[model samples]
Target chain A: MHLNYYQKEDQVLLAVDCIIFGFDKENLKILLIKRNFEPEKGKWSLIGGFLKKNENLDEAAVRVLETLTGLNDIYLEQIHTYSKIDRDPGQRTISVAYFALIDVDSHHFDGIQIDAAHWFDIKEAPNLIFDHNEMVQKAKARLKRRALSKPIGFELLPEKFTMRQLQNLYESILDKKLDKRNFINKINSLDVLIKLDEKDMSVSRKGAYLYVFDKDKYEKKVEEDGFIFKI
Target chain B: MHLNYYQKEDQVLLAVDCIIFGFDKENLKILLIKRNFEPEKGKWSLIGGFLKKNENLDEAAVRVLETLTGLNDIYLEQIHTYSKIDRDPGQRTISVAYFALIDVDSHHFDGIQIDAAHWFDIKEAPNLIFDHNEMVQKAKARLKRRALSKPIGFELLPEKFTMRQLQNLYESILDKKLDKRNFINKINSLDVLIKLDEKDMSVSRKGAYLYVFDKDKYEKKVEEDGFIFKI
Candidate 1:
């Protein structure tokens, strides 16, 4: 049974591009893979793949990211769709851009060895092909906004992190120097962190106390009083 | 030159759905058109059309809106793209949903005599076709979030609107009863309104002062100090 009611409508090739963000306790980075095939072969581009008929856009995005990093259950969000007619010179393709966050030390790339894939600091990333650079800039802007309103920055941090490390993550994502006292005061007011007795002695002699994100408490607060996470 | 390098991928029909939100002075309304075509004909759905091979998504949305309402130079935004595979049972169609704000009293539909079109209050809107109800919900959520971060509610107002009218617009969109004094205080603090000597006498015996959104001042403030419009 061929149900082709929209035969007159023009069909388009859709692709999903993933802007994988990771934090290395110092700087924010993005995973980019060298395009193996032309029109711009060997150029560094966001890891992407064409959407198949059997899968939806989210599934396609997940598949594309998994095919490169071999990681699942990552925090992925569909940011925007780029549909300039000539966005892709090789063909008329509309790419749905998704941003994913991962903790650098936790997610090891042990699935598949793609020598072309490399992680570059967001600031030093080379000019990508097509409308990919635009996509990156848009994704970064979305990440910045999301960081202010949501606790998504935890996705890019380890399970147990020090206050300084968390503050550094914020500064990196926001690309601004946040006053130390003010940042700590705001985070403390959120009341979504479990301050552990253990201290991280790696950064300084008088180590800082580590903390883990209290997801249960956060959920409870949200359920009871409609808590909004704002930075 | 016929460039067909990527022929080994699936192609899907792309559509753009417009969630046309209009303010009828007191309540937020959405303009819906009855689907005259197959599968779900006669059912109310967001005004939409299939994307042509020539135009981009934004252009496609603008054309779709104009084809129905004959209005141009409207404030339009690409909200999100829906791709649930079975979202459109007519075909494997991916629809990009855009939410447009229009002043209901100002923009008279004089272009096309589409008898099927009607405006329904947001709360009283009918169950839309396919995943349209979902699209509407998402668009409304986006509108609520955007209204808090940006001064987009002004797009749904007339050139000279009373403070009460502006408050009503916000209340309608937020679906909440706001404190009048607090709301006025916040709006005044933003300093983006020019309180004119004219008054809106239609609403009450004691006429309220009409204010016009000072775009020049807002732009200057934004340019000089990166002022974020938050309500």
Candidate 2:
């Protein structure tokens, strides 16, 4: 066989860990699960699973997220790979961390109680097991950067939302207050949002105009005009 | 034995591949090596090696890059991880791709003719084996994006360079023609460059002023003022 070249190479377990982000119209939250296994039993940890031989990292991440959350087709991005020799004390494992964004009210948890999993406001997240804490921090930083340059924030917002709602989402992800006028100017400059005729009157008697991210138009503009999205 | 939790997990071979970029004052280039072993013998490929048991991915990447280039302290960034089934014909391997930037003239190969390794202009590089081409493309896109928002381009240039040199480097990486006036204004607005009292008289009679990236000042500004670098 022509396999001698790779015969002596070390094989290590590959795991996929997910940092799932949710926006409940007010705060940025992360989903975490309590460990049920021996190494770190009862400790908080990111939802994760080992990669099977047939599936790729992306598939593994999606499968792991779905298995834990009972949700499907969530927006997942592979952020970074962690490979410290002793990262996972129970085994020699390298984990590829993925971040996902979901609107809190939009996705249902398939009517089953996921007792181990719970949502934590990003700021109040408990200490996670292994290198999972570092993984969450890195994923959060990536989310902040992506939110600034891409229209990804829309994933965490309802289809129709007021401008204040959009700014609030950005503020939560960025962890800082943005000047409202400047925020509006920048969003308008992107020219990828559609102002709908409907208004959200729940918060105020003089309702605020609602807007939705026009993904199709945004993608078409990027393809045809080489539009680079930036905030 | 408390090992049953992870005993049945699949372990696969891991590899580290590097997309090494260099600039020789006039153009951007990539380093490629001819594969000497089986499965893809004689094919051009990125410098890569199998991961070992003791080292983390970063250390493994640095070791692999140093082994092939005979250079150390090169600036390396982990760009992405590739894990598609059948990616490597000889074995199932997950490869983490890292991109490195080095000033071509500043470092010399430790003097034994590494005839297998060569630098090709970024635009003129040959077809690479086993998804290496895709890795290169992704790395180039990252470099372009990083150059616009960070001072990383300085790693590919001499300590002091003329404004035209810096602009050329950006143009080459971006693969676009930028307006000279706009490029200069944007770079100057970042306030991370120190215009030297000295001038480079090599290119023209009325010499252009040379500038050095002020790393210390840039860091201080970022720390104290929360300055964001953009160009």
Candidate 3:
């Protein structure tokens, strides 16, 4: 089963690591799991797995995310690939890092497989094993850049969310205090949200009106004018 | 030397393909080479090579570019990874695609290694082998995105370039006509360019002033104010 052309080449382990990001009411969080294997056993690490022979890297990332959170159809993006020679102490492995956004309240974990997994505030995340911390930093920078040019932040919010909640998500990701009036003006200019009669009563006495992202209008705008959703 | 943990896992051949982009006065071009080996012999393909055991993906990419162009310290970026199982017909090779920007006139080729290489206008590029076309498309999109957020357009331009030449590079990358006044205003707003007194008289009777990208100012601005060079 050996091929002559590839015989002299080195074949190394290829793995995929997921920087699963979630948003609660107050802050941004990341999903971290305690490793159960050797060479870095019982330490916090990004939820990752080796790529299977039958699957592509994207599929492997999805499988890893599903294995941890029992969630399907999440918003996932391949952030970057880390291939430092000594990035992994145990082996010369190249990891393709992916960032995923999920609504925190909607997807509850399946207890059996992810007993060691926990959500950590992105700011207070524990030091991770084998370049996982570097992966997190890169993913966060990518998420911030993406949040500016695209409407991907909506993926971290619930289906119905208030404008203040959306602003909070952006502020948390960008880690800057945005002018409230300016933020509202910019969002209104984009015209990608639809206001609903329902109210989010949990936040204030005079509840803010709920809004949903207008996917149809967004797609149409993108197709027609190449609209860029800049914040 | 088989590790017990990796005994049952699959290992595939990893390769790196670089889409080398160059800018001429009139249009953008790509460097493509005729394949000299099996599985795609004699066909036009990207400048590429298999990754070596000791080097990481970036190093492999740099090596491949240097082999073809005989240049170092050029602008190179990893665009994406192509891991479709059947992408390479000769073997199950996963290619990490990179896009490199070089000044075509500045870096001459090393004759012996790049005998079959040729520069083709991006619009008139030939059909490439084994999903290379898709890789080129992705790289172009990434370059466009990067050009907007960073001062990467200067990478494709000569050190001392006229304002019209700079605008043309942007128009070619974005594939749209931008208003001259608007574009100039935006560039002026960035304040990351040094206008030189030297003029280029090749294009018109009244010469256009030349300018150079201020790398130090741009870096300092990025560090100080989180500057985004949006155009």
TM-score for each prediction?
A: 0.94, 0.93, 0.93
CA RMSD of all predictions = 2.7, 2.7, 2.6
Index of the highest-TM-score prediction: 1
**Residues A1-231, model 1: lDDT tens digits:** 225558977989999999999998888999898887788888989989899999998999888778776878887888888999999989999999998989988987744526778889888999999999999999888887666665655688899999988898888888989999989888888788999999999989999899999998655554432224444
In candidate 2, stretches whose alpha carbon ends up further than 4 angstroms from where it belongs are A111-113, A220-231, B111-113, B205-207, B219-231
| Model-by-model DockQ, in order | 0.50, 0.51, 0.42
Fnat scores for every prediction? 0.60, 0.63, 0.32
Q: Pick by DockQ: which candidate is best?
A: 2
- Using alpha carbons, what is the TM-score of model 1? 0.94
Candidate 3, B64-153: lDDT as tens digits: 888776877887888888899889888788899988898788878884457899999999999999999999999988777666666655
Lowest summed-lDDT stretch of 10 residues in model 1 chain A? Answer: A222-231
Candidate 1's C-alpha lDDT?
0.84
Question: How well does candidate 3 match the true structure in TM-score terms?
Answer: 0.93
Residue by residue across A96-193, what tens digits does model 2's lDDT show?
99989999889877413278888899889999999999998898888876665555566799899889988889899889898899889988887789
lDDT of 2 at A190: 78
TM-score of chain A of 3: 0.92
Could you say which candidate leads in lDDT? Answer: 2
Candidate 1 vs candidate 3: the TM-score winner is 1
- Compared with the true structure, what per-residue lDDT tens digits does model 2 show for residues B1-231? 447878899999999999999998889999888988778889999999989999999999989988877878998889899999999999999999999998888988752226788989999999999999999999998887666555556689999998998888988987988899988998888788999899999999999999998999666544432223343
